[model samples]
Target chain A: MEKNKIRSDHPLDAMLRTDRIPHIWCPGCGIGTAFSACMVAMQASGINLDKTVMVSGIGCSGRGAGYTRLDSYHTTHGRAIPFASGMKLANPELNVVVFSGDGDLFAIGGNHFIHAARRNMDITVICVNNLIYGMTGGQAAATTPCLAKTTTTPLGNPDPPFSLPLLAFASGATYVARWTILHTRDLTKSIEEALNRRGFSFIEVLAPCPTGYGRKNKERSLDTLKIYQERTVIKNGAHPMDAVMDFGNSITLGKFVDHDRPTFSDNYDRTCRPHFA
Target chain B: MKPAVLTGEHFMTGDVACAEGALAAGCLFFGGYPITPATEIAEHMASRLPDVCGTFVQMEDEIAAMASILGASCAGVKSMTATSGPGFSLIMENLGLGICTETPCVVVNVQRAGPSTGLPTLGAQGDMMQARWGSHGHYEIIALAPASPQELFYTTITAFNLSETYRIPVLVMTDEVTGHLSERVVIPEAGAIKLRHRPAPKGRKDRFKAFQPGPNGVAPMAIAGDGYGIHVTGLTHDERGYPGMNVETQIEMMHRLTQKIRNNLDDIIRTESYRLEDAEIVIVSYGISARSSLAAVDEARAQGIKAGLFRLITVWPFPEQQIQKLAEKVRGFVTVEINLGQIHLEVQRCAGSRVPAVLVGHPGGAVITPEQIVDTLKTAF
Candidate 1:
């Protein structure tokens, strides 16, 4: 199937299965870039692609599951975490990954996010922070940076944005990282690291929604990628406390935290063993 | 004729037996909150599931408990959740999702009083109607009522089987009294039990469509990330699984969903007829109330009255044809229930104009006594 296809000049073309192409992504969408990074990361990690189950919630980013020519599920909005948690417990051998948008993961599913992290379930959550709701036509999202213009936030958003990596860290995720689309290799490495991690791993990739959010904020097309790359700084020996100062404009984008905690299922199995026996 | 084997044994209440029945059904995962009489079932599952390498999680609330079980079921496990009226009410929305998504699982409702926090520990069968149409939208459901703990255990197994066989949610609707009652239920050996499995779609890679129904109208369910084109949504979906957004598609989807159970009603509905052979007075009942009706039948027969009991094992599909045929021979029908008579209406509908069907109602925590049923029967006669 790979040898027969006419490869487009797009760098992502090599990683994507061409037959499943004519992708659902809109023109100038950074989701495609994120998708490319995800594919590269999966390919690089040497994890069993066949055993990898992708669970996604409702949103533009949720469609990532449908595009991946692997075993994936497009679940109900904001409900992918529980489903992914179940899959991991059912088959500890299988790799479970949740791909969701900012709105899907943080706003509506915020409660689930914290608890799943707190329990340290063995799963990877790759949150695509687009700053606004893209599928529903540029509504202000939980991560829509304050003063950023959206259809819902025409005069600019009054609500403050969420620092996703710090939130995950506080919620007890064993691994937390952030990256932008421009740093393709960095984003891939973060995803690779999250997948290989044994406990709940969360990665927030600042993906540009060139059509809705990007156009409204006056940073449309691939130019948004350049802006993100220039504005974000990679921090070495960074603690989650550092994220507090960089909230407004400058953002820290790198492997922010990586540690260990007993996963929910592992602890549950241990606690329940004596009773079942 | 051989002498009749008169074995009338009274044992512990129904609720205790229900707990034992769940253990017998091989239920390993139970996610529920403690609500009234239903709490015993949860307590039992909590204590027992671990012993069998099963899981029991008392979620923060009933909504999560219901949703979590649906998730666990998708992960290829037999799971259940137990609750009363309030908790059951909270689960209605997800129950509808369970129907549309075709997730196989069980919900045990130990009936309690009222619209809101009725009688907390009290008994009432008010949830009878909720079990059928409590969930939003139009979809079919399979419900069962156990008159004994033996039936509770057996019905739970049957509930699991029906859920798996049809790929739909099954409700084990036990009233507060039955949920609390205990009895000597014979646990069948593992080999003697028949476990139903749906048609599993083969070929791990992309050839599988998760919602595609087989010849039996039950589509094979694959765990998420099984490397298949598995797109499940709460929306009206086509066989290919992308959203179908058309009137024709909606109509076709509803028809298939409704017909899957309606067409298989014969195999799905089960009931028991006691002394129905030559009886002129028939009392139809189910759940805990059936025990009272059974006693009423015997008392009426002792008084030279031609009386019998028709106990419903499968409550939702409502053994219509059998009741319609029985109505031909019976002079009158008495429907006894714990609620202000829900299943009685179903019996009345099935009985048609063939006989006068009267309801002996008790819309409270107390069980409908056999004397009350006998009085109604005598008055009708």
Candidate 2:
């Protein structure tokens, strides 16, 4: 009798660089769920894998770029957006994605986030909002909910967190959506749609950090997912300003902005093509 | 189609000449911010890049501009960015990223006086040491200083070529005087101008190690769309480009990062020696001050003093060996720069206690006068 094969193939095995498996994500961390959804969406979207580039800044989610088998860059802290912008503008044929954390994207890289969205650069930004700086020992991030306990905010976070949907909508993102890690199917669909959309599509995924945010709040991953399932209210086509999150009140989940406009490269070609000719 | 090289003499400022040289060197992407003395470089590139079917992006800030150029270069396009003092300070963080990832790009710092925006409109050589050590790491950098508009044009092209050849971020350290000064620059024909192309990766894509060194210690590069599946990061990474936090990995990574340039200094360092044969007093300078030093040298020679000017074209590898050899023969060294003794420290280090190294510099609102340099030389002797 032949020896039984121990290795089993999975659907995402092709999409990931399996050699880099056993990733550094903590047990019950929601980044893996969000990243898995992104991978599934990438597979479902039918974009050319060879022409896809993933850029990430320094954080836990920054490691996503390294795990993906696609051509990826783990850039410096707070620089993924501009790096992705460079790739997209240099070759419009490529599908560029910026995948990083809330602290990396909203705090240190906030200026780039707004400007890239304002320019309406053609790129998909999947920001995983874990509410705390998970990689750096649970510091209060810009997206940390008010009154949330973090390492830095030992008592409670006094500062109000940014409403990501409203920020993206105001910054001129063509498509903006919000979802929790528990809503994997919905998040995957949003990512697929954003990947197909033309200019500056943004999706903010509220992920759980069992080791960081969860530990401080004394909540497990399952408990947060349960809260997300109970509290999330789907409001498609809702106004971005009405979608602000105050976990004590309610969690709004759906596409908040969907409108088309000329991207930076589109405008560049329209104005400069005659001169080039 | 517009030719890449202009191939004729044209009156242009050093900043504009630097842009033209970038075009002639086949730089297809320029990401920059508008800063004084360097603004004309971006202004010229804005109009010129589109005509040549190149990409030009005015980034939100200097940090983004620096990051964008690195990204464009990783995408298989030769890229560059230009900025002044304050912007140069912002670019230092990502400059380290460029060095760590071994990305090939040219960064032009048209120097202005500043610890913090001191004199944006005036020239200074304050960033000489900053260009070498501003990035917060132990890494070797290649910096070239141009003395005139003509030299800026050629040196810009040389900077790009050297960057590609070494797979490192090369700095074209010019000054506000050199940048704004207008002169006749003759751009050679496209065929006559030498260009260096980065070596393409050759092997199995899955098995390729992104940080592995070749014969010259430069790992072959692959663009994003290529099937290489390369992962580039800023952490101390192994040959496979995976982050390895151990001291052994850091030692190996740092050795490769620094030894490539340090081991090949003979090919990288370039300097111009004028009237140095049997001269008792040597004047060391670069950028605009070098021109002043040369003029002072002529004056000193006319006055029956054995004075020679040693102008640094490539300022960073410091040319320590040459300075060390000259330390024995020369009676003393007089260093002239717009900044307050930045390069003087390097000269002093190279020329030990045996010889005196005096500095004639200021806080840098104006140029160092040739008379001051001559007086310093006479007093030191």
Candidate 3:
């Protein structure tokens, strides 16, 4: 009998620790999709795997570093950016990437994220915004939409959500972009571009937490994806301030900031090289 | 080119001496936030690190500084951070993470008085007990106290070496007096300074377990970006370094974490005895208070009292055995510290009901005078 023609192997198998999977992601969670996009982007970037390190904070999305078959660190909550920055600055040859959730990155780690960007630290930060804290349960997050129902926000979320692209841009990120899980190819390409960028590059991927955010909102995975498809408008060169996310309104997606500037290490070397000499 | 270690005798504060010691130990990364008493150490490091091709990062907060050092260490470089009492409290959560991950790093807490930032510029040993039990978990720690600038210089190097050797975070618990007091410190040649590095795993990289113990019960470390593809987590993990939440796994992990330091207590614990052989009254002290205790002991000796000083060089493993043994020989024990009865409780616990233990301590803002310690010594009898 002839063997089946379809290939069973996955392209990301070599880049992942297969023994640790099936992963801890919920059945309909979009973090898996975002994580896969990142893996494929790293592969496409053609960077040295041995010289690449992934750092993550405490959350469901933080598990990306553990699953990746690379030099990775699972750091304390809200600390992945600084940890990755240390790796990048200590040895400039290492390719450092921080993968964590919006709650971890924006709430507790917000200062680190903004400061690193302002300093133009040479690192890639891939933040998966699931609108809620998935790992600790369906709690309200810094990225949760206004009027959204969460465990912490039982009645309704009164606080306005952060415009991640605007924050990254305002904080001096040399490269900034936003995408959703529905736009897999664009998200993958953006990550690849961010990986090759010279300064602090940030890509915020809006993902669905079906078990946490979706369960409370009474929306399924497909419904969330449909919302992304219907609301997101691609505006590559639009001003960052105009890219705010209002769940009922339009959500702008695409690279909002791309500029050339001296990174933290480059400036340090320029200023301190004479002293060393 | 400027040398990493400045050889010869020079007058410097304990904070500067500690920075020099870190440089001499080949610490390539210094990540810290500026807190009073400890801020001088960070300032000194900022100026010196770049000269020696080292990295100095002023992290946004103490927690981030702690996390940054752990990351740099995991990247296979010796790393450290310095802070004060409030900052130390901020670092406790990540300090536990560093312990659970078995990352090698040094945390220097140049203590100030605090229930909540009581006195930032004054001297206090208020963090002694907190250094031992600050992080919310059950794990053995190595902490050293330096009474003088000279001791600070040497103890900082020892702190780095012990952290690397044990694959755990080591604490250098200094006080405001020791940290700011300027004194002469002798620096040796870099070649003569002893250093220890984290050993690499000896097995195949693919099959290597990140937390599997070697002969010393410390798992050989594989640095980040070394192609080991290892996963490290703060949660209780097995030998493979994967998170395992069951009771059995928790027991095994906790035992290994505690046993590594407990089993090797002989090598880790250090204490200095000044005329302790034939003394009836013993003063148990550390940090700046140890100096005052020494003066009091000498005055007592001149007046014909059988008094001696037991200075704690390594405060954490408590030196319980030596204290227990000394309790059997001495009539009473007095602990002199800046805070109110921190280490005195430990002395009392060790001395038990057989011999009485007294405390010679103050609130903060001032060091305990020799007269106060002498009064306590006289009253103890």
Candidate 4:
């Protein structure tokens, strides 16, 4: 029972704390790729590991905090942001990051996500968007593509899906980007850039749940990775004016938005200057 | 070192004392909403916490406020939130979360009348039972009552330390009267204060279990960023921080959780027995009404009725053993509170069939009077 083992020479071998392996994720899952990208991003940022914190909500993706070597929190569902927000405010020196999923981050935690962005908190958020809920056996998720089959929606997804990058931009994130696990390099780079940004920065990493979502669609891990590779078209900076051009029936992944804004903590401290000497 | 004198400090209120106490207690994060008479606490905390490199946030609602403090606590900072009946009601779930997760934090309830918005800005001790049983499930809580601004200042410090020591949520339960009253509190010298720290793990990192009980029943708790690989969940969990649902895991975890408080009842329980040494009748009271009972007890003693006062500082765990001991010596019990016969039931239980219990109840915002309590004392005699 090696639950979180990562073999050497694997793409994630360098990125992981091999001794801490036997991750909380199930076998043949795509979350390992997302976690690998996260590790690479932290290393690339040159930030001190001592000052880094990873916070996660309750889900399969939420376990990212537990398995990661960095200081981490496994908080309640949809509450990772407020917890991370408090941590960031308590110690402004820490580089805080939130790892949550589409269902946990969007549906139940939708209010917090928008508010965290509105506050323009200076923390990076990497949402592992598997397009389906994998933890509870592939339930219908907020990011599930329209016309897809799931346990709850065995007939076909009737509701429309969100363009998460656009939603992040609308919610006041200073940096917003999207990438699939297959594009590890770009995903890792986007995460690094998000970490360095001054205000709220969000990277939606599209991962595959080969066990739940993939099994339902008769798609294996290789098939799911190929699907992500073929469907995604990278745009250096997608324009809001030509939003329709950037988004279609396919899953669009790229560096979608980048702008500077006063971080929530910085502005809050500035506003309460007399109180915070 | 000289204690901070409250001389000529213009009209300081009890809620303000609580805010100042929190600031002095090294509280660097306050997440709360504005609800009277608890609003002054938030206002003062907002004004003060920021001055000390701390942060104060008026969350979208009380749930966020409660959840935010839990987050702040995990980040290795002393944190707190203030609310009245309704806001306190909103925080029930998360308060339980804090308890089960062993997250040390403070919740101040400047209680107002309520089932739902009973009497805003008016006093009521109706929430005494709610403070103990508001959150679902079984667990122990430490709630302190302050009769004046002086006690409010001292009790807030005690509340934080209790929370940190036992790794449980501590409630500073005050009513509208005491919370709103303006009085002088002699702030103790900072050097004189003894703060409690959560027991930290002693051995190698791999040996640490977030829920493993020490000899005292409390486990060593490391903050999230301390890199202890600690895991906490609202779900029933084993000592290793993994979710546990089996009969054995469930039984052992919960037994330890409850014993963590019950086993250390001597240190955790606090009360003051005023002149109970040779008294024939004992008046049991707490919160604001206890002040009036004290006056009535003094008057009864002067008139030579042999009456005394027992003021419960730690309201939960109910001081049952102390009550039993007092019941043996005293002829009868007179229970006086702003609430109508709530704590009277507890008094009846602890007194058993041996001692008679008389309740002087007040069902509204108005407090119980000493004359009313005196009448009950007469009946007990």
Candidate 5:
């Protein structure tokens, strides 16, 4: 039966390296869904795909740069923002996108994130928030929920988590939004919107790590998605400060902030490039 | 665009000269942080890069500065960064990343005294060994040591050209004294200065292999928007630039990275010799210390001592052959430098039992004087 079966082309074959199809992403992992949503947004948006480049830091989601059929870079851990900024600044015609996980973007790469947003560097940053450091045996992460069980938090997580959207908005990101991987349609549309925007755009996609986080949390992958379906409340155009992710309560999911200001390139050209002939 | 070269003689500090050298070499992007001694390089670049329609970004820290230059280089621009010892330590991992990914760029280290900010205002050659082995793995690196502001200008240009030719980060290891010293630097006509550019990718984009080596062992580089869709990573990769996790791929990649440098020793390594014919004593040095060593060699020659100067222009790839040849003819060797014997150790190792290799060394904070070398030379004999 296997030998007789005819081959079929996947919809994303053009954007993906299908020969490397057996990706390291585990079954029931939400990272694959989040990655798929990003690809869909890339296609749906009208940007020239040839001019697009993907950059990733070290982690499970960092593999996104390696899988994409585009000019891509997998930089050192927590360095994707600066790396992406360099590429964008060097060639303003190229579209630079940074794709990585929570531990990478929020913890180690936190300083770069805030500074890039403060300068309003023209780039898109998609962060997959799995709550725990999934690649390193489910250690507690900056986004890990309070009282969540993980390897580092043997008893429970004692520290409060960072509100990623609030942080992005406060750091001067022009576009800020959040959605679960289960909210594929909303996530894809939001990513497309961010991609087309001019200033620093950040999209936080809450993903489930069944093997890494779920096993220790006493929840299965299906249960996590079911929780998202039942617990999430969509509230578009809400203040980004109000966007919350308290698993004990209803999760706030929506586009939180959208505005515009002069980007770094625009400011540089105006102030520094007097001889920009 | 503004002409990159100034095309005249100007009195400038070594740091400023290094910046002009970068401009002459066609470096379009400079991403660096502000650290003492090296901060002038960043400041000069920040002010001058705009004139050429290029970009100069002061990153959040040294790590980001390193990352930014690597990114800029991979995007088809000759890029660079400058820092001191503390910053250099922070940039080590990204330096390794540049090596692993075969990105062409330059890193200028205006080295100062350190173990931990030992003396920010003082000069030292303590990083001579660190420049060779600081980046965590066993890989070959090219480092040039310049003795004066004038030499720094030429060395910086040579650094960029070498990096482009060999797909590796070249280090301009200038000292605090050289960086701060002012001297006359003749910037020739832009056309007179030679430049080297990275190989450009050609053929069908679909069939193009990003890491597939040319006859020179350097693969053609493709930047973003080139439509070649190259994947670059710090992970071990194959000729196609895809990650290969196994040992065979690691062996192939490591061998390729090291051999790319090893095979081109002639083109990569450089040195300067002064009054060596029919001499029995050799005084070896580089950078700031080499300045006094030149004076010492001449003074010794005047004093009826048959001494010669062997100044190291390119410090790493060690110049083992030159030392071996010199050891065979010279009665003894004298290495002078700041920092307690860094490259002196290299001289000692290379000279072996053929002759005694004595170090005229200091432990940071002060310059090694020609008189001190004269004293050591008189005593060692």
Candidate 6:
């Protein structure tokens, strides 16, 4: 009862594993900010918190599911979406959420993301786009910049980064958005909106991996936040094609897509279960 | 307009029977990828699961399929996925995850020849040993090899039952011969068929340890949305299911994950003995080879040679005790399989110096005929 009182006063406490507090994310990391925003959204979403399950793949940001007090799953690398998709399909009433980093969601798990979006499965996916693989040290990721120095790309990356919003929109993500940790209120609101909506909703939050990406790039955590604040523009209804991220140039951030077709379950129920219906 | 049970005699393929068995076992979710020989199981599930309001998802690949089934199982659904060798190889990564998380799901591997997509259309018992040690790490697992369509039907349900009972993934290691061959399968009434649901969490929901082993070292699983607010991970952790990175945590976690199956080997391991009471030569086999072994045993007996069949129904946690006892009584043993000598190695290990274990096996393209086994036993053993 006393613990309940303390948690009620701190709304987000109820949605966190207080015992598992003091998470593994390093200080000055933007993941903590983005994660806080997510917790706030889930706490205030008004949906059945008891029924919501969080799933994460392997990465530093993949630990999101571990800290949450909901029925959470920290699945294998690149399997969070599929795992959560399985949960949503098994029981359509339950709210399934996938929370992980870009390397997990976009690179290794890229196929699942596109297919799940195409099927329009009702699950909210939050991708922490730190532009590098943080968990496995400062490695070059699929979202790594064309010329970024990292452990693997000490000579500078020859590959281009993916425009995640463009990918999500092209892959049929019903609700697409991009925000940074600085835009916590918007990120929270976007998550809250995705929580209430149906279909495969995706939000890519550009967070700073100070220890991984930042250390090699010569950008301190503060400098990274400064870039997010100054170098990014929020164009709420802009075309996803323009929602690119090239830290040197301007980055576009906003809710890029919000429309729904028949979800996988909707199609399943419509095409199947005649006598049961 | 078929019900999930379809409780009657139906002359169908083994794949169809396996699907029906899953439905009868109350498997509410199936996520799978379509591969040869195993494709029929997915097709059968696609047509049947919807009729029963069960979730059927054809995932992009075997990895996604394996991962999805684990997800559904975590949500309190009896889930399954089916595949062949190529697809089975892809499922290995998440299979480890399922093991570490102690997720209860059924994975059916309709064995075909493979190093990498070796013989797609042919039946092979080559994956029997793969079913034992394919996943990374040394963790105990339950795998059943059914010889016929009828046995496939019962074995699948038994797979799910053991999976739920032990809170671990069970493999229905049927081959393309057993999976594709059409045979008479009598589906018992729903009430008659046994089912094992995972024990539910007890006591206060807030303090529930998600990985705490209950009566039989199997933890009570609380599904998502049940308000138990449990956390499950593929990382090494304690009963609370948090990531505990240390030697002690690894030792404790590995013990619980593995010992659950090891301690209950008597319950988890199952086999069939035929004419072994007064026999001298014992023929050990599983899956399609077991069918041939049974015939070989009969043929050997008719020829005035004392031979009996020791058919391994549950191949993994390899029936050591029974094999050891047989080795003590029998003069020599013939380990018949489709692989070069996978289960034959296990047979040799169990048989020891008391009896010699000979392999009646080949790199599989076709089923090992009864004549081949009979010839092997007549000469080799």
Q: Estimate each model's TM-score.
A: 0.87, 0.98, 0.98, 0.88, 0.98, 0.98
Candidate 4 structure quality by residue, lDDT tens digits, B87-172? 99988878888888888899999988877988998999988888899999988888998888888887888888889888888999
Residue lDDT tens for model 4, A165-197: 777888999888888888989998889888888
lDDT of 1 by residue, B1-381 (tens): 111111233364565555555555556677788888788788866766666777777665676677678777776777788889999997786687778878888998888888788898888878888998898787899999987776777788889889988989899998877767666656656666677865677764456667777777877787654555466666787765556669987887787788889989988999988999999988888888888989999998988889999899898977888889988888988888887879888888988887888989886879888888888887877
lDDT over C-alpha atoms for residue B369 of model 2:
81
Per-residue lDDT of candidate 3, residues B1-381 (tens digit): 568999999999999999999999998899999899899999998888888888888988998898888888888889999999999999998899899999999999998888788899998988888898999978899999999999999999999999999999999999988999999999999899989988788868999999988898888998887888888888788998887879999999998898889889888998999989999999999999999999999998888888999999999989998999999989999989998988889999999999999898899889888988888777768
Q: Of the true interface contacts, what fraction does each candidate have?
A: 0.43, 0.66, 0.69, 0.42, 0.83, 0.94
lDDT of 4 at B149: 85
Model 3 over residues A184-257: C-alpha lDDT tens digits? 99999999999999999999999999999998899999989998999889999889998868667788999999
* DockQ of every predicted complex: 0.40, 0.75, 0.72, 0.43, 0.86, 0.84
Please say which candidate is ahead in DockQ: 1 or 2.
2
Model 1 per-residue lDDT tens digits across residues A1-277: 8888996566555444455567677988878778778988888898988778778888899988767656666677777786676566656777888988999999977877898888888999998888888889889988888888999888999999888888999999989888877788888988998889899999888877888887887786767766675668888447876854243368777787898877877788778665422
Best by lDDT: 5
Each model's RMSD to truth, in Å?
5.3, 1.7, 1.4, 4.1, 1.7, 2.4
Model 5 lDDT per residue over B135-173, tens place: 987899999999999899899999999999989999999
After superposition, candidate 6 runs with Cα above 4 Å error: A1-11
Which docking band does candidate 4 fall into? Answer: acceptable
Measured against the true chain A, the candidates' chain A TM-scores are 0.91, 0.96, 0.96, 0.89, 0.96, 0.95
lDDT of 2 by residue, A1-277 (tens): 2557665787899889888888999998889999999999999999999999999999999999989988889999999999888778777788999999999999999999999999999999999998999999999999998899999999999999999989989999999999999888999999999999999999999988989999899989888888788888999999998996767668999999888999998888777656653
Q: Any runs in candidate 1 off by more than 4 Å, and if so which?
A: A1-24, A138-140, A145-161, A210-227, A244-248, A274-277, B1-23, B202-206, B224-231, B240-242, B247-252, B279-281, B301-307, B327-332, B351-356, B378-381
What class would a CAPRI assessor give candidate 1's docking? acceptable
* Candidate 6 DockQ vs. native: 0.84
Clashing pairs in 4: A3-A22, A4-A21, A4-A22, A4-A23, A5-A22, A275-B50, A275-B51
